[model samples]
Target: FHIELPMSLSDLVRLCGFRAAASPIHCRASSPPHSLPPAPVDGLDESLLADDLGAMELELRHRDAYLRSLGSPSAETVARSTLVTDSQVDQIMASEGPLDRLKDLYALNEDNEPSYELASVMLVSMATFTYLNVRYTVQERRLAGVSFEERNKLTVFASKQQASRRKMDYITMRALRLGLKRSASSLIFAPLFLGGAQCISAVRGRSSPLDFLPSGIAAGACVRGAHGLQPMLGGAFLGGFLGAVVGTVVYGIQMYCGLTYEEMRRYRLTERSERDARLMAKLSAAREQA
Candidate 1:
C-alpha cells in the first residue's frame, strides 16, 4: 500500500516518480556512497589464527587422549596425528636420526642410566679446551701490552681455582654444561693434530691464521722499547697438560667425593705474601668494577 505524503513539490515528485532535482545535490542527498564496517574486535591476523588453531587442536587431542586412556585408546590418536602435513614434520625426522643412533649405540636399557664413557670423554674434552682457551687469552693479553705480572696472576688464579674445585663436583651436571659447548672449540685442539684441518674443511674456506691466533709467536712484544723475546712454541703444552691432569683429577674426585664446585671455591682462598695479596686485591677490585 502506498501512502501519499503532504510534502513540498520537489519532495513529492522525487519520491513518487523516483526523479532527481535538476542538480547533482538532490541525488547524492538521498543515496550517499556505501562504505564497509570497521574490522572485527578479535581482529586476529593469519599467523595468530594459525597459532590459536594449533593450540586449540593440541588441547582437544590432550583431552581426547585422557578420555580414551580411561578405557582403551581409540583410532582417534593415530588418525589425528596422521592428519599432520608432511612439511611440518620433515625437519623433526631429519634431526631424529642422530639421537636414535646414540641411544642404540649405548644400548640405553633405560633412559635413567648415564653413559659413563660418553660423559667422561665430554668432561675431559671440556677441561682441555678450557685450558687451551686460557693460554690463548694470556697470549692475547700480552700482545695487547698487558703486563707479564697481569698474565701470570690471571693464569695462576685460574689454575688454583681448578685445583681447589677438583674434589667434589657431580660428573653429569658438569658434563652437560661443558660437553656440547667444548665440542665447538676444535680450532685450538686441532693445531696439534689436524693443524688447521677443521677450518680448511669449512665451506667458507680457510681463515687467516692471524684472524684467530692474533699474536705471532715470532713477533715482538707490544712494548717495543722495553721487551723480551716472543713466547716460544710448546710453552702452552706444559700448562695445558697440567691443566688437563688437574681437571680430570678434580672431576673424578668431586664426582666420587660428592663435593661441589661451589663448596670448593668457598674455602679455596689462601694466605699470600703481603705484596701478592695487595696485587690480588687490586685485581679483584678491577674485576668487580669491570
Candidate 2:
C-alpha cells in the first residue's frame, strides 16, 4: 500500500508498495466456473451419471489450471503473471500520427540456454520505449491524443517525459541506422548492441536512477567474451562506454524532470486503485466454485 504526505504535487502523497520487475511478460483470459448438470433420464440416469463421471475426470484434469487463473497457483503451475511496458522510443516506432507501436517478437527455441525470461523482458522494453517516442512526436506535432490542461500542470510533466524520450530515441535510431550502413560484421553486432540496450532499459524502467558505467562495462565484457576476442578489454571498454552513455542520459532526465521512474509509476496508482475496486465488486458478485 502506498502512503500519503504533504507535497506541492499532491499535498497528501507518499510513495510505497510499488515494485519494479527485472523485465518479462504474458498471461491469459479468465473462464466461467463449470458445474455438473442434473441427470434427466430414468433407468438411463445411472448410465448418464457414468457419463457424467467421465466428464468429471476431464474437468479434474484441468482443475489446477482453472484454480490458478483465479490467482493461486498449483505446485505444477508456472508462476507467470506480469506485464512489461513500452518506453518513449518504442512508442515512436509504433504509435499515433507519424508514429507506431513498433514491436518485434523473438522466438526462443527453448533448446538454447539463454534465459527466456530476460528475452521476454528485453522485448517488452523495446516495445515500451518505441511507444514513448511515438507519443512524444504526436504531442509535438500537435497530433491527436494530446490533452491540453487548463492550468497545464500535467502538460509540463507530459512534455518533459516526451522530450526525454525523444532524445533517447534519437540516439537509438541513430545507432540502428549506423548499423544498417555498416558491413556484415556490424550487422552481426546488432544483437550484442541490443543486449547493451537492454541493460540500460532494465535499470531505466526501475524506480531508481541508474549509473551507466556499470551497465556499459558489463554489456561490453559479455559481448567481447561471446565474440571470443582475446584480451577482450577493448570491446568491453566500448560496450561499457556506450551503456554508460545511455544510462547517463536517462539519469539526467530523471534529475531535470524531478521525477524518478518511481514517481512516474505513481501516476499509475490511480488506475490500479480503480482496478482493485472493480475486482472486489466482482468478487462480491459470486461465490466459490467446486
Candidate 3:
C-alpha cells in the first residue's frame, strides 16, 4: 500500500498552517495563567485566638466586678464561688441517700413558675390518703355484719363512700382554685415587683431621696384613688401567701424528682459538650474532604 509522491516545502508549510488554523491552541499559556484561585484560610493564628480569649476573660471579669458591686453576682461568678465542679454535680446526683441530695436540691436556683401537674398529683395523693383513713375508721366500727337497722345507726359504707368522694372532690376543687389564684397573683404582682425594683435601683443611684418623687406621686395617687391601705395590704398578703404555696409545691416536686440546680447545670453542660463534639466531628470530616 505504498504510493510515493514527492511534496514541495511550500505544500508542507501550507498543510501545517491549515492544521494550526483548524484547531485553536488548548494549552494553559494560551489563556491567562489561572493562578490557583485564592482560597479562604481556615486556620486561625494561635496568637490571635489567644488574644480573643484573653479579651473575653477580661470582659467577664469586669462584668463580675460590676455585678458584685451591686450586691449581686453573675451566674458564672456564683457557680465559681460555689466551687462545685461537674464531677461534684455528678456525684451529688448519683448519691445513694435521698436526704443527702435534698440539701443540694434545696440550694438549687428554682426561679420557675408553679407546676399545676405537681399540685394536682399532690392533691390526689392527699385525697387518697384521706379516703383510706376514713374507710379504715368506718371498717373498725364493725358495722359490716350488723343488721340493716344497726348499720343504719352506724355510718354505712355507702355514706362513707359518698363522704370520701365529696372530700376528694373538695380537695381537687381547692387545688384548682388555689392554682388559679396563684397564677392571678403572679400576673398582678410580677409587674409591681419589677417596677418597685426599678424604682429602688433608680433611687439608690441618685443622691436625693426625692429622686423617686414621680413614682411616689403615681403610686400614692393609685393607692389613694383605689381601695385604701387596708384592702391593698390584705390583697398583697393573700397574693404573697398563694404565690409562696405554689412555689413550695413546685420546689417539693423538684426535690422529689431529684432535679437539683446542679443536676440541671450538669445536664446542660453535657448537652453542650455533645453538640460541640458533633460539630467538631463534622468540621473535621469536611476539612478532610477538602
Candidate 4:
C-alpha cells in the first residue's frame, strides 16, 4: 500500500527510449582510451570533404579571373622586356664607315629636303594671311549690307584676289627678314669668331692665312689691335666681303623662292586661261546654235 520504489536515472532514460544514447556516456566513462566511435569506420567525411573541394575550386576560379583581367603587355612593355642596351646601339651606329656616314649626312633624300620645307613654310604663311584677309573682306561685305546670295557669289573671287596679293607680300617679307638676319649676323658674330681664330693663330707664332671668309678682314682688323689706317682698311674690307656673301646667299634663296612662286603663278594662269577658253568656246557655240 506504500509508495513504489524510485526508478534509477538509467532505467528512466531507457524507458524514455534513450538507452542507446545514454549507453555511450556510460561506456566512455568506463572504456579504455584506445576506443573512439570505432574510428569513423570509413576514416573520411564525404560531405565535408566535398564542401572543402568546392571552396578550393571556387577560390582557384576567382584567382584565374583576377589574373585574366590584367591585359596583355603593351609595345613599351615589350620593348623594355627586350631592351636594346646602349652598347648595342653604339655598335650599330659604328657599323658604318666614316665615308658612308658622311654620305648619309649629306644625302639629298626626303629628310634633307630643306627647299621643300621652305616652300611648305612659305605656303602655310601665305595661306594664313590669305585666310585672314578673306575673312575680314567677308566681314566687311556683310557689314555693308551685302545680301547672302551676292556675298556668296563674290566670295570665290575675293578669296582668289586676296590670296594672290598675300603670296607676293609673303615673298617680300621673307626676303627682307632673311636679308636683315644674315647681314646683322655677319656684321656682329662673324668678326668675333674670326678674330678669335686669328688671335689663336698669332699666338701659335703662325701668320694668319688670308682665308676668304666674308667677315675675315673686319675680324682681322679687330684681331690686329692696330691704331691707324690699317685697322680701318681691314674692317672695311671685311665688311664688304661679309656683305657680299650674305647678299649672295640671300639672293640665291630669294631667287629660288621667286622662281618657284612664278612657276606656280604661271601654272595657275594657264589653268585660268584654259578655263576661260572653254567657257568662251561654249558660249560661241551656244550663240551660233541660237
Error of 3 at 10 (Å): 99
The true-versus-predicted C-alpha distance at residue 273 of model 1, in Å, is 60
From the highest lDDT down, the ranking of the candidates is 3, 4, 2, 1
TM-score of each: 0.18, 0.30, 0.26, 0.18
Q: What is the lDDT of residue 214 in candidate 1?
A: 23
What is the Cα-based TM-score of model 1?
0.18
Model 3, C-alpha of 231: deviation from truth (Å)? 2.3
After superposition of all CA atoms, the RMSD between model 4 and the true structure is 28.3
lDDT of model number 3? 0.47
lDDT of 1 by residue, 186-239 (tens): 333433222221122121221222222322111112212133333333434333
- Which has the greatest TM-score? 2
In candidate 4, which residue ranges exceed 4 Å CA deviation? 1-77, 108-290
Q: Ten-residue segment with the worst summed lDDT in candidate 3?
A: 202-211
Q: Per-candidate RMSD vs. true structure?
A: 27.8, 29.9, 24.2, 28.3
Give me the overall lDDT of model 4.
0.46
For model 4 the TM-score comes to 0.18
lDDT of 4 by residue, 1-290 (tens): 78775897667644544432346655456555353332123467889999999999888677556544654333234334444445544454445344543343223444555433234434544554455555554444344333333445534645767755754554455445444443443334443433333333223322222222434455545534355787667666765576457545643564666632223323333444445555665565456546
Error of 3 at 187 (Å): 4.3
